[model samples]
Target chain A: MPKIVNHEERKRKVAEACWRVIQKKGIEQATVREIAKEAKMSVGSMRHYFSSQKDLFIFSMQLVMDHVHERIKKLPLSGPPIKDAMQVLSQVLPIDAERRLEMEVWFLFTSKALNDPDLKKKSDEMDDELYQACRLIIEHLTVAADWKQETERLYALVDGLAVHAIMRPGRLHPDLLLSVLENHLKVIGQNV
Target chain B: MPKIVNHEERKRKVAEACWRVIQKKGIEQATVREIAKEAKMSVGSMRHYFSSQKDLFIFSMQLVMDHVHERIKKLPLSGPPIKDAMQVLSQVLPIDAERRLEMEVWFLFTSKALNDPDLKKKSDEMDDELYQACRLIIEHLTVAADWKQETERLYALVDGLAVHAIMRPGRLHPDLLLSVLENHLKVIGQNV
Candidate 1:
């Protein structure tokens, strides 16, 4: 019998290697040769997994979003709308090592997307997804007046905290992240 | 007489070129050769201004920070603390084309700084400066309780709005930005 390869698993492995390269060096250095070396695969084989660097980058960034979505889907939303919303939002934050890597990689891609139109589309889609999530949480919380403004506020606060946490994890600890978020929710709840 | 060249002026011109290259292409493309071409200078002469690309980048990034600082310093803060604070914060947002370029370049450098230790120090200093500014505004606002939390909240909100505005200027308009910010301040005022 001949050995068989899991194509999807191999692609995922390569994408993870790309993430490590992006984190260790800046995204600019995430070249195919470098990623191939990082992935412990021959460059020719790497091409088999991803036709081009752009394709690889798109897949890698999409993986980060998929991971967040997966985590959010798995969250045990045992009620009290604010707490459950917090649980959902926490899925996107860099609260743990795993999520931290995802957030960092996600942000690196976002920065790259500024000039790369293909990546820009992906970045915009993710932003819209996050915005919709915020809107959903606001609706669930029953924020009565100016809910649109409230949704924007909540979205900005979440992203700002995520950026700060990723940039300076020591200063913006998980406890403080939860505290800031909880306070915002409480204020919104009171507004209802 | 030998040519009277303004050393500082030439360097400023080169830095401005660097900023344009960064904004147009990504930061990785802001190489000495590319920046020299953009600035309409020879590679040999570019060396006289910045010994290395790293030196040029450092100077360029610092210029962005200095520009923001200069703008804030010149802001005519004819009071009503909340409005004054908004004016100070607005200087950092991408409200105009000039500021939008500054912000875009600033963010690109920030992402690069994650993997570059030398740039990391500069990025940290700017974050601390912004944090302190937020604290000052919070103090001026005289929020009696949890002022620290409030400061962090405000800082995150401003940065979050900035990142969003930079990413999707079409969606997050200047009007919406001010409205969201004004609403946050109103809520904080109510808390006090």
Candidate 2:
């Protein structure tokens, strides 16, 4: 009997390959054939997962968002409120290799979103999710930061850190980035 | 007398035209001919100012940095420190039409900096200038903030606000953005 291949799993694998292609080469280089080769599968096999290059690009773009959601969802949160919150939130920035890849892919998709309506719609949803998460964190902390103000600042800080990490990785280290968040939260009445 | 344009002034005008072309179209659409047309000069005349499209792009990228420097220098710092500091920083974001145009062109050039060596050099220089300015602001504030941490965080916040303002103009208003920065700064040490 032949081994059974998990259809969804294979699709995700191909999408991941597409992300790598976009990272190494520009997004335009992420054609179906190139993605298939990167995934170590035949072009026909990859087509079985994605109907066309557009389908593949959309899938890969969705994959980046899904990966972020997955990381945030699975983030281990326990212990003191400030420390746990900081640890969980830190996952969003490009402090390590994995998050760096996600950040690179995110920026690429964001630029593409400017022109692609479908991508723009999805991108808006992600932004809202980020905003909501910040609101929740600020509310949960002992800090009495003004809800509206803190929410905007938190979202902006996340974006700022990600951009710096991508452009000036050597300068903005993980510890330094964490220290900023920690001190800011502490000032607002929370101890990180 | 026929207007005999200075070489340096003509070059600056051509580069400014390039920025307008980028703002109107995507960077890929900003061709030498298109920029020349926007500048209302012959392609030959434009070439005399900028040797090639790459040269034009590099000069345009630097022109933005120069504008930012000029704006920062011009911001009135004679008033209350906190209010004046906020005012100075606000120039960097998309708070007004002029700054909005600058922010838009800055982002467009940023993406190109990834692949273009000439643009990358100027981008790095601008990044350094930004970091230095943020450091100076943190130093001048005489706040209780951990200098290294607060500088990084505030810098990130400014950059983040700029991105949000450009990308989600309707959602993130300029007033709200400034309020957030004010509240965040106040928490650190600034006061009425």
Candidate 3:
């Protein structure tokens, strides 16, 4: 029996190429021709999946968020809630090659999204997810402190690390990021 | 008296247009035509100050940095070191309309700078200024700790606030950011 091609998977392959194009040449150059070239597909083939560059960009940005959510979902749920939470949030930081690219593309796309309403809507959705994630961690800590303040602080630190890691990689190495994160969590009542 | 046109002031007028363009239309659309229209100047007049779009962008970005640095420098210096430092660093966070637009354009322009060499060099210099400014704050603390780690954490928090304020303006309000900064500075040995 012949199997049908997975359309979502095919689209994701093209999105990955979009990331590479954005990474190598900046988002401005993530044109249909460049992305198709990077994806090693003819523009005709790409048109089958994405009718326009805008469509591909939207799909690619959504893919970036989906990947983060998927990774967080697959994380092993163990240890104290705070510890598990740190693990989940660390996915946002550029701790490795893959995560690093995720971060670079995120910054690139977010900047583009700032003035694009369609992309801004998607960006806002991702920001909401991150804000909620921060709130979840603070709630799990069993602290009497205001969750809103702590959430802002925690999220800021996370965002800051993600940015500094990409901008000043030598300074905010993964090890430093972990220590800073752990200390912040501890202050909020983590045992260790 | 026939006063000669002040070239610097004229260039700044053009740069202001650059900010408006980046803020209203996003950085990618900040072309010569768009900026000229925004500045309400003839394209020929705009070209006299910035021969190329690249030069205009670099100058505009530098102007953003200079504006921030100037604001911080003008802040009162006679206070407890921690309190004074907080005031200085808070300039980077978007606490008002002017700062808000400054930050939005900064992010948009910095994203464009990521892939361009001349812009990247200037961007790196600005990053260094921020890192050094963080160090200056840590050094001003009363108690001695590992300045490097403390500097990194503090800077991350500050950066985080600036970014979060833009990305989630509803949540990380200026008051909350001020309180958080005050609390973080206290942890690092602010007596008051």
Candidate 4:
């Protein structure tokens, strides 16, 4: 009998390898050949999974998004709106090792997305999702006169904190990240 | 007699060409050979200005830092702390075409700096400068109980606004940028 292979499992493994290559080297080094070597698979077999480097990148990025969505979905929300919102927002921030790696790869892909149309579409979709998420949190928790601006502010703050945390992990600790978010929520909890 | 050439002027020209290349193509395409071609100079001559691609990248990124510093130094304060602070902060944000290009290049270099020690040092210096700038603005403007947290909050917000403006210029307009910053300053003006 022929050997059975799980296509989705193999593709995910390849995408994870691609993420490692990006983290160790840089996105420029994340070519199909390099990823295949990293994944311990032949380049030809790699092509079996992803037809082109662009497709691989798109898959790798989409995987990161999927992981984030999965985590958010699995989060156990408490009673308080502020506490629950903080828990939800923390899903996207680089608060832990796994999320940190995701944010780093996401940052690199976001930069590449600027020049690649296909990657840009994926990047924009993620941005819209985050924006909508922030809007939901704001709409649920705040009675601000201009909730639109509040939503934008919250969205920017989350992204900004994630970038800073990725860059200076020592300085922006997890406690600090939570504090800033909590403070922000309190300030925007009601019309100031 | 031999013709005299301005070294600094020529180097600045090369760096600007490098910026154009980075902006047009991705940073991966900003190789020394490609940069020389973009600058209309021979690769051999390019070595005289920049010893290596790393040096070129450092010089190019430093030039951006210098530009921001020069603009901030030249900004005329309007006496009010909030207004003056907004103007100062706006220099770093992608509020205009020139700044937008600078930020796009900065964002690419920042991502590249992750696995690069030399570039990471330069990136850290810029982060420190921005952090200190935020602290100064907070010190001059607010008496928050925990000024450090407030500083971090403002710093993250400024950077978040910048990244958003770069990614979605159409959605995050200049007026909206100012409004968000202004609102943030006002919120952080007095102790909560």
Q: TM-score per candidate, in order?
A: 0.97, 0.87, 0.94, 0.97
Q: lDDT tens digits, residues A1-192, model 3?
A: 546878889999999999998888899988889988998999998999998888988898899898898998899887887789888988888999899888899889888887898888888899998989888888888564667777877888898888888877887899998888877787677421
DockQ of each: 0.76, 0.49, 0.62, 0.77
Q: Could you give the CAPRI-style class of model 2? A: acceptable
Position A6, candidate 1: lDDT: 89
Error of 1 at A95 (Å): 0.5
Task: Provide interface RMSD per model, one decimal.
Answer: 1.4, 3.3, 2.9, 1.0
Identify the superior model by lDDT, candidate 2 or candidate 3: 3
Model 2 ranges with Cα > 4 A deviation: A1-7, A28-54, A142-145, A190-192, B1-6, B33-37, B40-48, B143-145, B190-192
True contacts reproduced, candidate 4: 0.64
For model 2, residues B1-192, the per-residue Cα lDDT tens digits are 767768888888888888788777667678888998999989998887777888888888888888988887887787765777787787788899888888888887776676556787889998888888778777777554467777788899999998887778788898888887886666555521
TM-score evaluated only on chain B, model 4: 0.96
The fnat scores of all predictions, in order, read 0.80, 0.65, 0.75, 0.64
Please give the lDDT score at residue B110 for candidate 4: 95
lDDT ranking from best candidate downward: 1, 4, 3, 2
Worst 10 residues of 1 chain B by lDDT: B183-192
Overlapping backbone residue pairs in candidate 1 total 0
lDDT (tens digit, per residue) of candidate 4 on B63-167 = 999999999999998678998999899888899989988998999999999889999999999999999999999998877778788888999999999999989
Better of 2 and 3 by TM-score: 3
lDDT per residue as tens, model 4, A3-35: 699899999999999999998898987888889
CA displacement after TM-score superposition, residue B146 of candidate 2 (Å): 2.5
